[model samples]
Target: MAGIQDHFKRDANGNVYEVDFKYVRNHVPLNWFFEHMLDAKPKPMSGAIRYGVCPNEPACQAASVHSVKVCVKEDSWKCFSCGEHGDVVAAAAFYWRITHREAGLELMRADVDMLKHYIPPKPETAIERDDSALALVLQKVAEASPYPSKDALAYLGGRGISERVAREACERGILITIPNDAFQAKAFLTEVAGKELMERAGLWKPDKKAPACAFRPLWFRSQSHCAAEFRLMREPRDGEKKAMRYGGKSPWIWEGQTPDDYMLVEGPIDCLSAVEMGSKRTIFALPGCENWEPNWFQMMAEKNVLMALDPDKPGYAAVEKLKPVLEAFEAMVGIFNPPNRIGDLNDQLKAMRGLI
Candidate 1:
């Protein structure tokens, strides 16, 4: 007997009215829609979520479908893939390209009892946990002294990174190079943590009877705890020319509350360059073009995003690849390529000053 008229009508934004369907949404569970209406399989769900491809996205229905999130409460569903959002009936309408009334009729026919009868599972006991043990290592790395001597400053100058910026970064532990006096680095790290932790964090390892200082990222929590970043400013040494370039956790961002926009760049150095040029937008440096998730997009759903990805071939290619991921966040992205066609933003700044 339940048909189109049973559910309420549309809204100014063309979305199904949430208030009218309050009773149905409360009774039916989200998993019910997936199992009965969509016939889609979600990875074994544990929490209050069931994630899958957006039914509105053709590519998503095929492979790597993590764009749509259906919350346990059947009231709402959002598709990061197509930016399609709606209540359960609206979600079904978007998926089937039908009127909200028709979608409601379909739900009325679905065996809602299967979902409605379910009860939430009990929570498990809490236990101590530390997934990434980089916090203490970060402190130890921060304790390691910086290279403030003339050679260190000159090295930055040669690289076109100004002395002022370097000093500001060094004081705040944003940018720090290997202590030219390797012994100082050893003493500083040892005071904070033992030699073994220093080795664990990879400050340096003895090679050929000398402390071959590491040129890797030191992970640290930024001022905004939600955003994290790593910096690598080690002054290159002769014997360690080919030592592995270091990297830590991938997700990093500059200090900010969730801003109205984001300034995405290729590396942390490029992010600092944009900041130096006076951009207050939250700067997020991609670990690399290939990966960009497992992060805080849920916190940025309504924000605009501008990307100053590098101007080179790889940079362009990365942007192209990232279109899907950004779309999934429903981000309004502005492609802001460097004006001077330099490889990256930092290079553009340096080139303008004739430092390169």
Candidate 2:
């Protein structure tokens, strides 16, 4: 009885038996109880209680007639006055218009165990590991060597390549071609009339037989360690002619033990010009204006990369794309601006008389 409230009925041993209806109703608002808490009006019976017609009906009893004396110590409103009384959860369910289980769940403030069952897991990403594509491209170039000699050397000399430089290029196996047949050579000379052509004009025919040469510069980390390889294609065909794919990869840039800074030019002739001009550092040529790759930056991450491309729109575009990639690898990127209308490093060198 010590803990029992006025609304609870207790035995002499203080065991609670029932709730006091009047006290419960007093604590509940009439409108709320009418709308949510009850099933029907209650009536007094012999030793129990009976429910009257539901209040939702037009005609209903004013008070309960039940004999189950629902009373509180300080109140006298009859248990027969209201129709329902039950446990706390049941009452909450009735008031909230929800099921008993739902009411209990709602009252649980810290239950987080249900969240683990509905979340999805994440996926992994794949990366490319081999440089086979580059190797294949190099192989294609290798198969296209030994282009016509006169056209090759004339092309070199037109860019103001010196006799010593021309000889050196020849020594490096840079492909040169004189028309294999007199008629073909005569036809080529007639086609290229008025230009101070090479005595041995190298004609690069798209027909796999075109003469070509490859200069592969090797750089080693130790006497035994080959770090990188540079490939150069010499005396390429004119823009219109189909030429064999020569001048790539057999001769590639090799990173040496000593940190030798290098210049990255847009053509093999440009690299040759740099060498002729006494640039002690190695010069690597991209196949064309558009052949640069992100891997080029990765390969030269520790070296100084001077972008000596042609002074043209495509050259500028290539430089713009290459700048950020080189910087990202902590390499120094230098842009070379030529004084003349030359399109490439070799042009610039020849125009400037072999000055860097």
User: Which pairs of residues collide in candidate 1?
Assistant: 80-328
TM-score: which candidate is best? Answer: 1
Q: What are the per-residue Cα lDDT tens digits for candidate 2 across 232-337? A: 2243222211122322222224232346476777555566677766776666666565655676657668678777777664577778887888889888888766
lDDT of 1: 0.55
Error of 2 at 165 (Å): 2.4
- Per-residue C-alpha lDDT of model 1 across residues 179-231, encoded as one tens digit per residue: 44556655554565565554544433533233234233333344322223433
**Candidate 2, lDDT over the whole model:** 0.43
lDDT of each: 0.55, 0.43
